[model samples]
Target: MKVIGVTAPSTGSGKTSVSLALLSSLNNSVSVKVGPDYIDGSLGSAVSGKPAHNLDRWIQGRDFMRRFRWLSSVYDFAVVEGVMGMYDSGSPVNLSTDYYFRKIGIPYILVIDVSKLAESAYYIAKGFIGRNCIGVVINNFYSEKHLIIVRKAFSDHGVPIIGEIPHAEELKIPERHLGLKTAGEMPDIREKAVHFSQFIDFSFIDKLKDIPLIPEDRKPLLVGGGNIYVAYDNAFNFYYGESLDFLGRIGKLHYFSPLKGEIPENPHMIYLGGGYPELYASKLAEKSHLNHALKTYSDQGVPILAECGGLMYLESTFESKESSLKFPGIFGGSVKMTGKLTLGYTKLNVLKDNLLFRRGEVVYGHEYHYSDIEDSWEKTMQNVLGKGIQGYDGLYSMNTQGSYSHFDLMRYGKRLSGSIAKFMR
Candidate 1:
């Protein structure tokens, strides 16, 4: 498989442009998002008209190397958009995109915010360069002179000037909490893409024609012929395309929806990914029967893995389109929307052994949540659960696992894969 990595000096610089232009310029390429970023994933997926897979070492695991290999199996080219910086701003932790990139031996496109610095652009790019770095894309350029000098600096290093994208007032992505406003919130996101597409040089997309996509080896690392139920409904839809494909190697996939149809028959696992459950709370509550089925599945010891919005659905209530709505209350908590934004990257360690991940094993992940679930005296004591480990504090908490960390599956290679494998057992 041909793979290209897009990274920048900092967040919101213009790696999106590099990714969009490149992926759009590819031939049926698959997009893989690194870190716990969702906006870039949504944008990249839309660019290729394919589901983008998230490979976050924190959310996924260290041993998940095989999962990455498994994910890009059939794709001709894979574009991985990096998180914050190429190297960890803090520590050399598990699930970092850079860690995964070096592990997978994939080349990348360095995008630097050259709005201020001229030759320094080349310096930042050089500092973060690797054997995997293909070239540099100078993004968010402010002046033509700066662009010229910046281009020349890279030229001096023999680095190809892939493309230079100027800053535009219109292309700003809307944000709330930690992640971009749920893709659903901005119905006009397509317009933004179209606008960016106009100014973005699509030639870079074509330049990647011969780039190699790293391929995956499908070996049975998990239990045999596993039955995996992937969540795909509007309520819980932040699942990684590659995650499912990787899991598919060891099992049969049965997709069940709480907003659309019935749950699949007797499956070994129930997968609930992340999404805006608050946006579809009414619909989720309407499907009381489905909720009951989920509760039954959980009671019967069917492995259920949920994250963010998926976790919210498992709770008792969430405010939505209709009045206050009630759900399965499988884990028993009240999910409420908050005007305050709670979002950022995190390092979560598994405190207790569970189906997914091992104790003290670290996973590099992110959490962007706009809702709050307060602990009640009765529920906390009765369930012996403390808001079920999520967000930043409880990010690395215990069993039948999940969190608000909307990270890419690639980041948490081994740890995430092994952890999830435990649930299948």
Candidate 2:
């Protein structure tokens, strides 16, 4: 498939908007985000009508290429939406999108928001122009005269101006503390993307060459797990596409909405991912049936994994400024919504055996949340790199495990599947 990346000079530079437009304009296109962002990928999936995957070199390492090849082989084209700035690194140690672009050998289009600058836009664009940069897309431009000045400035540079997007309020995606709202929340997102597509020149895609696919010999590792229930809704929809794919290979996936107080019957395993649970805290707290069911399942030793918002939902109460609401209470603690945002990549040293990881195993994941556990909690994993609750994470009760760290199945699939297999035995 012909692959192209959409990157920006900085965050909120219209990269997701441009990427969504490209996906809407292309045929049989699939999308991937460069980091552990769940919201942008959801927007891409909505525009493309397919599951959007994530490529985190820090988490997946060299295996990212294998997953990329597998994704390329399935679609006619792929649009990779970059995380943060093109060269912005998570840390001094972690690699960035520029590294991935060079390693994957794909050219990228630099997106620059020219709303605030006139002549300086060119200098900003010029700084980002590199070997892998194919062209530039000027976003949030004022008028014909504004576009003329920026175009004239770039006239000296050999790089072509692929597109000029006007400053339109309709193209903007609503944002909260986490980032852009999910595509489901914004029903007209696809229409907005289509509206944005009219401003862009898609002729560059025609000249892009195809990437050869590599053969995949990987096989399913888990066995004898009958049913795996996953929490999926507006409150709990933060999940990696590959993580769900791996689970589907091992057993049947039954998605239930915790907001509706739904729970699967006789579940072998349960997965509760991260999402805006705090937003729907009261509604979720009203689901006494789900809370009781989850608690009972945990008491029965059913393997359960919860991350971030999921971890909060398992706590006794969701404490907010208005009032405190009840939750599953599996962790016997209260989670209070905080103004302080905890966001970063994390490395975990597993202190105890869990459903998806073994004791002493080092796992790489990320944490992004605005909530903190109020009551003191027991911990199963030690945070070696990023911030954790007093250098500890992974709260476990019987067979249930909850943590703020979110894992990518591309890196943890084999180990996770094996752990599931062992538990089934």
Candidate 3:
């Protein structure tokens, strides 16, 4: 299918808004986010009636691009919403919008903020103008005169102005510390999506052409053979859509919430992804039965996979700015809330053979957390890229595993599913 990327000069330049508008304009189009960010992908998923996928180079490397390109061929058109800025790259590699555009070999439309510019919009577009940039989209232009001037500026330089979206108060999405609220929580998503689509010009939507379908097999992975309990709620909702999809394919996936004081009934394995666990530490601590259940399960050697916020929730204590709360203490580490933010893409080398990874095997992922464990423990993975710090990550104890790194299960589904299957066995 024809693929196009939507990028901005910088963050908060209406990239996600424009992407959702474009998705609404197209007849049969889907979108993906080009970073480890789950927020924009969630919004795009809600706006467009499709499960949004994240295409991060660090997590999946180059293979994900090819796979996504192939998978997107099923749709009439595909759009990729970029993260941060157009040229911003992650640490230790060229994992940015430019890198993905060049590697995926797709043309991108630059979204320029015209709220503060008229003629200067041309210069802004020029700074980002390259062979990959097919056209430009004027964003936040409230006045018709400003839109005309910005359009004329690009048009004068022989560059096409594809769309001009006006500044609207209702267009701004509600956000928390993590970013935009998950689409499920966002009110009037459909109404907002329709309103945003009115700002875009759909005449050029025909540019997206169909591509040859390369045969791709979609076989199911090794089944878990047992029910899997997944921690999911506002406090622990940072799971990738692909990860949940894979889980559904492997076993009967059930969701439980520590905040609700509920534990799954007889779970074979517990998968806690990540989210704002620190925000609800007190509520989680109040759930005595849930803590006891988790501790009991760990003592019984039931396999558990926890990441980032999940790691914090499984800690002995979760210390936040407001209050200190106790957890299961299944893992001895204690988490401390701090102003410091640890965010990056990581390449983890397995230090020892485990169900999820083999000895010496390398796995790629991302980490974004503000809380830090108070004490160091024996680590199973070594960080080759990003700030894994002190050459170690992931706390391993018996059948329990916890880490700060969030992985791309879509790219590594087979290996992870096989590991989960083994855990069930």
Best by TM-score: 2
Off by over 4 Å in 2: 217-222, 415-425
Candidate 2 lDDT (Cα, whole model)? Answer: 0.86
Give candidate 1's error at residue 93 in angstroms. Answer: 2.8
Q: Give the Å shift of residue 348 in candidate 3.
A: 2.6
TM-score winner between candidates 1 and 3: 3
Clash count for each candidate, listed in order shown: 45, 0, 0
- Give candidate 3 misplaced runs (Cα > 4 Å): 211-215, 389-391, 413-419, 422-425
- TM-scores for the candidates: 0.69, 0.96, 0.91
Q: What ordering of candidates by TM-score runs from best to worst?
A: 2, 3, 1
- Worst window of 10 by summed lDDT in candidate 3: 208-217
Q: Which stretches of candidate 1 lie over 4 Å from their true place?
A: 49-51, 54-61, 64-73, 91-107, 112-135, 138-160, 166-174, 181-216, 220-227, 261-268, 319-324, 338-366, 375-425
lDDT of each: 0.65, 0.86, 0.78
Model 1 agreement with the true structure over 1-425: per-residue lDDT tens digits = 66788887677677776676666667778778776566678767766788777765555655456556765676778888887777754434554557777876777777888777878888877877776677777777878876888888889888876666777666677665445664545666556656555654545545554434456665555545657788775566676666665567656877777778477686776778877777777777888778888878777667677777876777777765447788877755677887767655555555555555556656455556678864331211011112233323222222344455544533333344444455566
lDDT of 3 by residue, 5-66 (tens): 89988998888887888777676777788888877877777777887787777777666756
Across 303-337, the per-residue lDDT of candidate 2 in tens digits comes to 88899999999999888898989898999888887
User: By lDDT, highest first, what's the ranking?
Assistant: 2, 3, 1
